[model samples]
Target: MTIRISRRRLLTTAAATSIGVLAMPYLSRAADRPQITHGVQSGDVGADGGVVWARADRPSHMMVEVATTESFSHAKVLPPIAALPESDFTAKMLLENLPAGQETFYRVRFRDLAHPAISSEPAIGRFRTAPADRRDVSFVWGGDVAGQGWGINPDDGGMVTFATMRRHRPDFLLHSGDTIYADGVIAAEVKLADGKVWKNVTIPEKAKVAETLDEFRAAHKYNFLDDNVRAFNAEVPIFVQWDDHEVTNNWSASKQLPAAYKERSIGLLAARSARAFHEMYPMRESLAEPGRIYRTLHYGPHLDVFMLDERSYRGANGENQQTAYGPESYFLGPDQLAWLKRGLLNSRATWKVIASDMPLSIIVYDDAANRSGSEAFAQGDGPPRGRELEIADILRFIKSAGIVNTVWLTADVHYAAAHYYNPDKAQFQDFEPFWEFVAGPLHAGTFGPNQLDNTFGPEVKFIKAPGQGQQNLPPSAGMQFFGHVRIEGATGQMTVTLRDRADVALWSTTLDPRPGKPG
Candidate 1:
């Protein structure tokens, strides 16, 4: 389990002397090279600063050096942070006093406490601080990873979509959900249709469903094994939220797992998954309560990003009838919904983006034999029901408060599409019109153009799914998708583009703010 740092050809006596007495006491000349298994990452960028993350193969003190320039000449080294086993030896340091709207370069190295000079190879990363004022803002977002037996293959470019995404150079990436497939296993090879074989690099922990805390932690670590993902994380800051696969398929807080997971309680599994998630990403802590992931980030005066937590407080997936609307169906819970409403009403940004983990109007079905039910907002075809009642209440509040230019961005269905929900054609028409854009399955199997429940008067404007007679295309085939948004500072307009793995634009549209005009 030790990660050896790659050794240099030589360490001259003069260079060792330059390190001085502070370094001599802990230097281990006989120690082998220490490695950084997972590369460095940065996230939670603010106007002044952000957080940088790294993991070492062994117990060590993580040191992050920050600078305005690429070289170490002007660098300021942060105090050493312990990479403890409590967090699976991962460590993150909050960077401060950085200039606004400027790119900051950082590098991480691990120092073995017993042999301090025996350090891991330095891993370099960069991210831009949030703008001090209104300026053009751009970001990319998608979800679902290493699912349906798809794992990284070195021969086929190792999650190449991530490399494609890195080229866009967005300010950050919002991972909508399904950060890992903890509920599924990865085999050495998967047999697809037409007798074609998709190969993968399988590890012992990922060869079965995650049950123990260590297993869940391993699931999150497995994603970092891809070089493309590591390179992408090194450059672009990420805002992440979780979906069901982090625990199990279509899971809710109240639902019990099938017999296969009978040994471990759902609560226990979720706790482990949440801890692993926080350790792996540099997300800001929730102020309302500890272990909460939903939070808001303001990107200058042009955009406000609200990341949601759908799995934490939701009701069971099968309780989708109209009768379940009041007490039995709880999505986002009461506190989070209230926070979202208040935040939206008070936000003065030109565009308020709800980084939802799942789409609103789509009907997500469970695979139970005797029961028919849905996940997400819409339960019936014509009107607000079940969890949709919660969404309806939020939308109604926004319209009553005259909040304008609110849009929803999500990706749980593993397809890409654009839908316009206009109350002009709806049964429950108390809300203002808005748009919801969906995209995803970053490097997993690609499936479906999901059916839309018309409760919110959703009209599909554009969609890109698998061609006829095909479903769940492998990542190697280049069918993965991601969405990008660019907001114009001067005009306050937003353009959203959906692109395939090759970085070719599939669909693009410009949206202008429309004042609230309730029906």
Candidate 2:
């Protein structure tokens, strides 16, 4: 039950040293040795296994060693895997047969392919495996990093919200989409609304919109340049999903080529972005459906997170007002919706958390300037139309199957709020009452308190956003937010709290699990 981390490997040193730098190869003590660039990360952890990821500066072999102690006494060395040019020098390997409910420490180093004797300095990472039995569980959820031209600003503390979240020391982070803003360019400096200068640490790859495969890869890598993000990744595992920004803003099958993009084919850009997304994160691969983002992660007896991908399969974005189940109504798509229902029915956990990338009732515009076209599920406030049909179906299915304790957590609209969906007040009232919590803009522009649609009758309980006539406010405005959730083992009650970058709780509510639901 005792776990510890070395002083040098912990967060303080990482925070003080690695700010806004790419951990480039040439900066290494020995230029010929392969460097462990971008540090290390762990993800998709469960009772028995997890995925370990790291990137190297050159073609090398990634070697990993696992241990239960900080001193690495009796550490077990795993087989080495090759990191080649095909994957952009990034590699991840599944670590199996880990003990449940215990802290696991792993060390990663890259050995030069040309000279096996030469190896880079080891990067350390730690994560606690999911409990085999009922126990207290806690985690953080948020997303939207480096979005809306807000890149790493070292002068402004280099994405300090990540450091704030890391202080909580959650078991993992449920990153609800917008992992990177591939379409958003990052300049060296930006002029804020207050006439103050916001300095950014920019690279050539992030200077323009991502078009080529390498550009997409670089976009993902750009986030790691922030020391806070890298330190957070080393300590906590991440369960990640992608939304529109991973490819482009409001991207769909019918997206028009923008003036900034030289590569006209949206399909090609999407393909490259998907490849880079899979390469960058430490998510488990789906053999059945390769590059699939939607999957279930069983954290323990108390929690099961259902990660959804709302971007990959969908119709074109427009005025989403379809009245029936069709291409335009496909939000989760048919396959993913079925998988979610099946997973919910099969789950035995106390809390069934639907980790959606987009909120249900918040009206996100595909064309924000014109304020027309639906980017999310809510198409005005009337009935369950367009993409809302798919969500309504899922909600109805959850109710009919008597699945209790179902909650939705999302982070796409760049703000934080709480909504209570009541069937009695709804236009479509088949679903049972539930709670949907929203939080985000982990380190991006803060813009909402968006208009809510009453299709499923969502009543806003609380909201925090920019003032009227204000939008895309910088993180320096102190509006950045994230959600923290904890489930008590003995009581089976889940508490959700919305907090800002300063780690101050803005609002919170505790929900008791439904009766007769197995804990």
Candidate 3:
């Protein structure tokens, strides 16, 4: 009845083996042990509870214990959750009745049901529950990992930006989509602009574009294999969303896949990618609607985050004609738009944060000819068209409702910048002024300072892009970027800061709740 656990034994046997080094001696000592392969993660942190997640090397009953203290002297043990093959042997448990606005420590272990005594090395993680009342909250938002042929390179610190973000110790991380480059292949060696070859640890599944369900799952799994990513996930609860790279580049429901992915339809690929995404991340699944990823989360009375699913229900990237726009031409479909409107109107929080996977004003041009289209909201240089129409409607509604302090955070651009959109100088002046901050390519190449469409008058504040016309700057050169937001509970002021891989602030700006229209 007494199961003795040893941290030393666990670290020596399990942790030591995963860091790009072989632990043959430890493996020999515990050949049958259920190893916690992907490390531990916590997410969906509510005021009273949160979710703890872990994966086992084999089918086992996963156990989680939560406590306020690191020692876990008075830990609350949750019911055992089965790590089944159906879910790739990953298990998650909801820890309820946890104190709000406080750091909660948790430990996870896997036990063989047949042999109750045998257990895996315990994996530890921590998360902070949402505040029950007004409290200062800070969180980081960014995306586009292992993109532009940049994969995990253990020799070069392996996505070191994740470790840097972890150092900030944000309450949660809003991963603004592109969780994996499912459609992008990672080669063993990539030739950079400086004629230096950047090496990557290439796995079979990541060597080619993902098509099969298992391959898609492997793509998501590849991220966790990195030590830095695993360490970051352990402490920060992530609010995940999906972008085009999760399936393919500039993908939509209507677009036909190239001959390479002829075996799988776009819908099937999206489904497979979504399933893998849900399985790998610790996001809360809705019981009412199981597969829905777009939802809202309230962090105390100060912030309400609306995580959008841009890739799920979208029109074709080439549907850019203003006259061709209708119900079918949607970025955020009618249903999602209605839901967003309702959520924005119903929210009592001071700041309504739209965690968009893509930027609105930036011209994300598609590969189609005529130069007449974009993958994002912008369609033309003038007024709202196609997807931009939907955005304009939402912004107009927000302004008419007098919803202040609305901010948009996105990361698909592969660079970091701040843009303040003002209706005073816009073509369609129905919407009030707002700020949209873009940062990303977390471990990918740096590119943009993308051109802005005047559909909504957006003035660029600051931008940090790759120099010398080089887009694919290796991570080792320190071009990666991410943004952090800190909301002061007392003054209701929000400070947004963009930082590079070196943890140096690229840009920082403080905004009052409603700055009363920019001059």
Candidate 4:
């Protein structure tokens, strides 16, 4: 419950002060006596700046610093930063005015002022700046890496997925949701006498919190403890947002959770979770503001990425007719809907990618009693709220506005699948062709086993579940994999490739947005 740094290693009051203020004696070198337990982490990279972070194994509060160069040998280390008692012993430092489309290295050392406190060997990694002009760029993003368990094979799951993505060398990583399973429950693997099996169980300790602030903090630390998860983070710059699991599954804005929020005294559960989310992820100010996680990033004029917040503005589940299936009745709230509409309408990019935590489309088994699957299990009242955003209306809006170059990238369905949405539902409206691509579980287990058939084995359209050809693990609905989206800004062409941890390209597809025409 507490994080402490020992003062025994204090630099001679005058010795450490000289590090940046003045030249200190050649106290020590990182390689000579390294004390870092985890590797380095960098995030929030923009044309102007980014964050450099790391943790130490020894007890010490030292200053954290960074340099624009991959080797700190000739770079400047900023002021010494002491670790706050609240965050255990982790240190996150901001580096400003970093060069674009380049690499940076950072170091962490403790104070005792007497020595360098055996700094951790610095980590060097590369990142790309938002294209300043129309040029090609590529990136990857997906979320909900809850822990692994059940009959799952660790070697063949999330860890493998991270290895797959590492091969792509994306500019940044966008984590959509459920970065950690805060509820902390797993399947019981046994059938209850009442004929109800506990497919998911919420841990009692995490459930007993009076305020969600501490609860969410606990969840973050749990995620950082995973080795494979930490490695994926070390390699890429991460832009993140919260989904249901970070707090509670399927939480809509202001929607109450009787078992959890009902006991909280301070701020709403959503607010508490949001704070914890930002504190843990090195996300920039764009998504840091409350109720405004929606924002647009333009990779030159080649691609315009719109990250949306669907659950917050969503209408409660159930059969309540009257309004058109969009905007006013959108899964995206008022502010977000408007922003998205304007962003889409104004985009001149070759490709428009909408990053959403929930699938724009997924199976919604109506009828509450017979309902199953993850989303249904997390809904409120009536038959499962199957596709409430009025899939029809949203698609129409995209077409009507001439937002021709658009594609949706999403996770959370637990299974990786690709499909095109027809504004014209095949059953009714003429199908308007818009495509969607999905990937998953960076360092979390493959989707919790499917209820009836235990379908981790891929029978659907997708590639081999990583290593399955060489070693093999159960196939997954969304086989633990990461998404690699490569776009040629010049040609307005996009190529998507999915890879397993073994660096094998599993599945891929291409899309071409020719001015205002469909691909």
Which candidate number maximizes TM-score? Answer: 2
The C-alpha lDDT values of all candidates are 0.82, 0.88, 0.83, 0.55
- Between 2 and 3, whose lDDT is larger? 2
**What's model 3's lDDT at 139?**
94
CA lDDT, candidate 3, residue 42:
82
True-structure lDDT of candidate 1: 0.82
Question: Of models 1 and 4, which has the larger TM-score?
Answer: 1
Give a tens-digit lDDT track for model 2, residues 1-519: 001223233322232233211132432467767888898999999887689899999988887777789887556666578899999999898876677898989989898888776788889999999998888999999989999999999889999999999999999999999999999999988998789999999999998899999999999889999999999999999999999999999998889978999999999999999999999999988979989999999999999999999988888898878887898768889999999999999999889999999999998998888998888888998888899899889999998888999999999999999999999999999999999999999999999778888899999998999888899999898899999999998998999999999999999999999964452
Q: Count the backbone clashes (under 3 Å) in each candidate.
A: 6, 0, 0, 21
Error of 2 at 92 (Å): 0.3
Can you tell me which runs of candidate 3 are displaced by over 4 Å? 1-28, 323-325, 368-372, 515-519
Task: Please give, for residues 218-324, the per-residue lDDT of candidate 3 as tens digits.
Answer: 88888888999999999999888888998898888666787767565888888888888888888778777787889998788888999898877887777566655
Per-residue lDDT, model 3, residue 93, is 73
Candidate 1 ranges beyond 4 A from true positions: 1-31, 323-325, 368-371, 514-519
Candidate 4 residues 110-221, lDDT tens each? 5432245344444444445565565667788777664433222343343445555665677778777777775544443424334643243233334443255667765675
Determine which window of 10 residues in candidate 2 has minimal summed lDDT. 1-10
Work out how many backbone clashes candidate 2 has: 0
lDDT of 1 at 277: 85
Question: What is the lDDT, from 0 to 100, of the residue 127 in candidate 3?
Answer: 92
